[model samples]
Target: MNRFTTMRILRNIVLLLTVLTNIGCDQISKDMVRKHISYYEHISVVRHHFTLTNVENTGAFLSLGNEWPSPVREILLVVLPIIALIAGLAVILFKQGLSALFRLGASCVIGGGIGNIIDRAVRGSVTDFLHLKFGIFQTGIFNLADVSIMVGTFLVMYSFYKDRNPSPKLPA
Candidate 1:
């Protein structure tokens, strides 16, 4: 294969690996939580700073649309995200001329998105169980999928910032 072909193949492999790894991590942890934790019961992980509390969220982030009428919530939470995740995967897999960081970020986002989408499709809700608080900085219970999203968001943001303000290359 030519140099260009080899590089493209490598990129594809790397992207696929990143995507699968994140998805696997999220799904496995969620499965463990589902099997072990009981609803509304929590075990403190850090002496009041962090805990695991089983919750099945039928809505979006922080249970945003949970109170909405069923049909509306279903369409908004289930159908729309499926469409969005498909579009995102298309971008990550098909779009060319993207940087390594861009592909990594996109893969991470898409991976976690698919993991949660699977839960919503099969279970009718997403599982969440990690809670944290540092003094007054509290957070809604979340899972590895949420953490993946946050990491992916930061990576994407960093990619944009770096692209906009690239550093000068030193001479050899």
Candidate 2:
């Protein structure tokens, strides 16, 4: 194998491992929460501001589509995400010339997305428990998958920010 080919293979392996690690973390955390927290139960993990609450979400982010009709909800929440995730995975794997940061972000996004999809497909809902409130700023109850998604989003955005400004051009 040529040096270039070998490096390509190594990069692919690293990306796969990163994705699997993210997914594993998400699934394990959810499993732990499922085993310990009863339905609709609340546990204060960090005083009043930060609490753990068990709740199942059957809708899109922040329960936006929770009230949608069943058929619509299924197509929008489940089918669309599966399709998008597949497309994203293809881009991450096959798309070349991407920076390492971009790959990391894509992997996290895909891993987290798949984790939630597994729950929705098998349990008919996504398990969410972590809750946070800081005065006027409050986050909807979320899970590890949510955190992964957010971190991935930030990484992706950061990559863009860094790439947008190539070092200031100086006159030759």
Candidate 3:
């Protein structure tokens, strides 16, 4: 194979590996939490600030549609996310001139989406365990998949910003 063809093959492999790695980490952490932690049994990780607890979210982020009917839940949470994830994977895999950072961010998003979708499809909910609170600042319970999605979104946005407003070059 030509050099360019070889490089393209390597890039595709790396992209697939990155997505799988994210999904694996997310699933592994959730599995550990499910096996070891009981529902609502809070274990303090940092005094009252960080905690480990198990809770299954039956809807989207922050349990937004938990009260919705079963059909709506399935469509919104499982079906739609699966479709979006597929499109995201295709974009990262085939889009030309995409920077490494952008591709990584998109892969992370797709991976995290798959993780949550797997839970929703098989378990009827997504497992969430970690929590944080500090004085007036606090956050809802979440898992590694949520972290991956948030970080990936931030990275993707940052990449776009950088592209639009690149740093000035210093005199050579």
Candidate 4:
């Protein structure tokens, strides 16, 4: 095979592996949570700081806009993910020569989005388990897919920051 063909094959393989790994992680974590924890039950893992709790979220983060009618909820929860996945795939395919960090970030976002989309489509809800609490403040319950997306977002932000301000060098 020509060099271009070989490189393309390698890139595809890498992307596939990245996607599979993310999806697998999300699924396994959700499975474990479902098996071990009861819904709405909280198990403190770290002394009022962190907990493993089971929550089925029918809507998006923090259960936002959940009071909508059933059809609207389904469209917002299910159809939107499908659209985002398609858009993300298009960007991944058409955008070329992106920095390595940006590519990694895009892969992660796509992977996590696909994972959650699968859950929402098949289960009618997203399984969230992790819970963090400190003092009187508490963050929303989230799952592995959420973690992946958050990391991807940070990576994208970092890449943009680096691009805008390339590192300065010391005098030799």
lDDT of 3 by residue, 1-172 (tens): 9998898789989989988988999999999999999999999989999999999999889999999999999998999889889998888988889988898888888888899999999999999999999999999999988898998899899899999899999999
Candidate 1 residue pairs in backbone clash: none
What's the ranking of the predictions by TM-score, best on top? Answer: 3, 1, 2, 4
Q: Total clashes, candidate 1?
A: 0
Error of 1 at 170 (Å): 5.0
For each candidate in turn, give its C-alpha RMSD to the true structure in angstroms. 1.5, 1.8, 0.9, 1.8
lDDT winner: 3
For every model shown, what is its TM-score relative to the native structure? 0.93, 0.93, 0.97, 0.89
Comparing candidate 2 with candidate 4, which one achieves the higher lDDT? Answer: 2
lDDT of each: 0.88, 0.88, 0.92, 0.84
Task: Tell me the tens digit of each residue's lDDT in model 2 across 1-172.
Answer: 9998898889888888877888899889989989999988989877879999889999868888889998988888789999999999888888888888988998888889988998888888899999998889999999988888889999999888888877898899
* Clash-forming residue pairs, model 4: none
Off by over 4 Å in 2: 168-172
Question: In candidate 3, which residue pairs clash?
Answer: none
lDDT of 4 by residue, 46-147 (tens): 996999999898888898856778889878778887898778766665566667677677778888888888888889789999989899999889999998
- Candidate 1 positional error at 148, Å: 0.3
Worst 10 residues of 4 by lDDT: 89-98
Q: Model 4 segments beyond 4 Å from truth?
A: 169-172
Worst 10 residues of 2 by lDDT: 14-23
Candidate 1 residue lDDT tens string, 1-172: 8998898878888888888898899999999998998997899988999999899998889989889998998788888988998888778777887777887888888888888888888898999999999997999989898898889988998999999998999999
